[model samples]
Target: MDCGKRHGTKYFTVSSAENFKECMETCAAIVPCHSVDYQARTKKCYLGSHHNNPLIIASSFDSAHSVGCAGACGGGGCCKDARKDDVQEPAPLPDTSCGNAGFEFAFFPNDITYLGPNDGNFNPVVMKRTQPYYKGTTTRIGVTDAHIIYGQTPQNWEFVAVNHRGYLYAHQDGEYSFTAPIADNLSLLWLGPNAYSGYTRANANLEAAYTPVDSAPLEYKATLVKGKYYPIRFSWDNSGGAGYYELKIKAPDGTTIVDGTTTVSPYLVKFGCREAYGARQYAPWGEEN
Candidate 1:
């Protein structure tokens, strides 16, 4: 995306962007990119702050183009740079802590277990169901995140592949431990950028399975920043009858900040559309915001 006029020099650009979402990820790195414009056919992604569609001056149109915001800018929100050349105000910030709650849960039918790309069970046909064709949100994902991102959960719980997406706000900066002591069939947990971007069962930091004894239960330790939040993806599947997916995280102080027994620790939070309707809107991005 062109820095979208003004701003003097180009702030960000991706030579070979895989998709518009990649542009969002890039713009978000340097600034709070609230809007985006993408062309699938040309693999072109335009990052802007404009109310996007309504305010932007001009841009090429393509049927494959997708224009929307990631959080507040969704549902026909702007995808253009809304910054003024003279004003030079800072971008909006996300919540500091406890503003949003609960992890967004999604369940994929017919696939009860997760198989990484390298796993023997991994194949094209099994991955087809996880494509998310039904979505207006997720299309090429393998059982992923959010409430509206995947719509509604199936009524029946048994024999379904589950995906949990959210952010884990690190209360303190230090080494933190993650584990899934109670997981049925199979489960995978990912932290940091991979948790939001390209995530899969095989690359999970922590994997727990009833059958695959080789999969480790604990991720030892991962360093986090003080008051900073990292994207967390926890995915699991239940074969039949009864199943449970419990995520447990330990803070630097040795206290179980995220207790599986309690179900949800205040540290677990989900952002986006749900926030706008709440009393306080927390920052969906890192604490630095």
Candidate 2:
């Protein structure tokens, strides 16, 4: 009720001070009303504003509020309830045919190290002081029907043609095939014992018992460790072999750890570090190269 403050004749009447106080108390009890003030000149009481707000009280329980205030104050169940409404679960995986989603291995950039014999790898080797070789390129050597026995043995035999009394001789053979593919932009040297080395008479025979072939797609398994690098090793199967077998690998990231290749079958091309990736695609039996 507005008791016209501009008019001197305007008046407000109450039964008693207690009654007036009760009315003032009731208005004061309202949330935004602070207190009752009695005007000195007009003798009229005015209700003032207050600090009470209910909306702020409601927001105190929100998840965003809890997250924002982290350790400041222990928030109430508002955060928990909000979380219940906002929470979600991950989606199901896709149906895959090839084992491990057509992935047989993960060849990380730095997980390949190729070592070799005589022509050495990773370090220099002193072969008889006069014949010193550091490391050779990715070249392959093979032979066919040199009469070799295929089985598990401490030392498997590899074929190489040799010169006998006056004719050409062969050693360590079965129908052997080697595949050594050349990497683009990378220099590789294919060394062979010029057929003349096998037979006393040289007749423009332009082949070696050990000839090179295209290499297979290298496969590896790796895990990322501390320094944004992957620690890994090569993994493959070599069930049947006449003598010796080897594996060669290359990293896509310009870091070549393998100098020449390994002569050991089912070779473990172990290495130290590599970079990280979100998803990896590995080689599979009939996979498109």
Candidate 3:
């Protein structure tokens, strides 16, 4: 069979077709087929795995044309930058007096064995925390002033799982380092400018041990812009053992944003889209309705 158009990688072949539309349909049925070049003279079709490929003049067909089958596929045309539409540009950094770096913590009982990864347990707690059986928000994520009973059972069997969500405000633009209290099971993640998406969730594990320092802390590094709230989420599980945790932030200026010994309070504000009449409506920051 003649390879029409002679563009893109060809991994499959459709033997026969009555017309161009039928040939195009066959290409659509294949998962990896991104585009197709049809030869009307011989009623033959060539499937390609790529959208952008140099055109080649094939003598076997009187006329050759290509069409993109994949969604957003350029179909032998110039490929457009898809990221421009998929990701939102960073908004102007707010004033320095915008807010502080803190997170809201919701605690749940892990009575049953947690079978999956640490993050897998996070969503369930977040969605069910307000439910009747859920234990509810026990405390803030910062350093605890006193011993807090996160969760407990009558039989002395205790288990506590906490999910923390909030923004980390930067005073100035520069590289920043973060560290959290080392625990038996802890997952800490920071989503900044380079990797912040409303639909994307951060899930980085930070349970590394420090050799010299006894207070081994989970650490992460990210370059942040001043007056911006970088979304962050952290999940910790004591697994029925001693539950003690703290959050610490070190700015680019070498100043400690939140010391391990002090308590950091959440902003007590919410932002983003809200559900209204089966549609999402943009709600201004700190605007509650």
Identify the leading candidate in terms of lDDT. Answer: 1
Best candidate, TM-score: 1
lDDT of 1 by residue, 1-289 (tens): 2322222112245344565446555556645444454554566655545433222222331111122333433443333333233222221222534445666554466443445432235221242235332212121122222222234554455556556667776767789988776555566777877676656555678776653323455554799765455787776666555555556688888888664444436666665322321222322322112
Give the alpha-carbon lDDT of every model: 0.49, 0.22, 0.44
Give the per-residue lDDT digits (tens) of candidate 2, residues 103-143. 11211111113333211121111111221111111121211
Name the better of 1 and 2 by TM-score: 1
> Which parts of model 1 are misplaced by more than 4 Å?
1-99, 112-156, 211-217, 272-289
Model 1 poorest ten-residue lDDT run? 56-65
lDDT of 3 at 212: 21
| Location of the lowest summed lDDT over 10 successive residues in candidate 3 | 273-282
* Residue 33 lDDT (model 3): 71
TM-score for every candidate vs. truth?
Answer: 0.48, 0.17, 0.44
Q: Residue 232 in model 1: shift from native, Å?
A: 0.4
Model 3 regions more than 4 Å off: 1-102, 112-157, 193-202, 205-215, 264-289
User: What are the root-mean-square deviations of the candidates from the true structure over C-alphas?
Assistant: 15.0, 30.3, 15.3
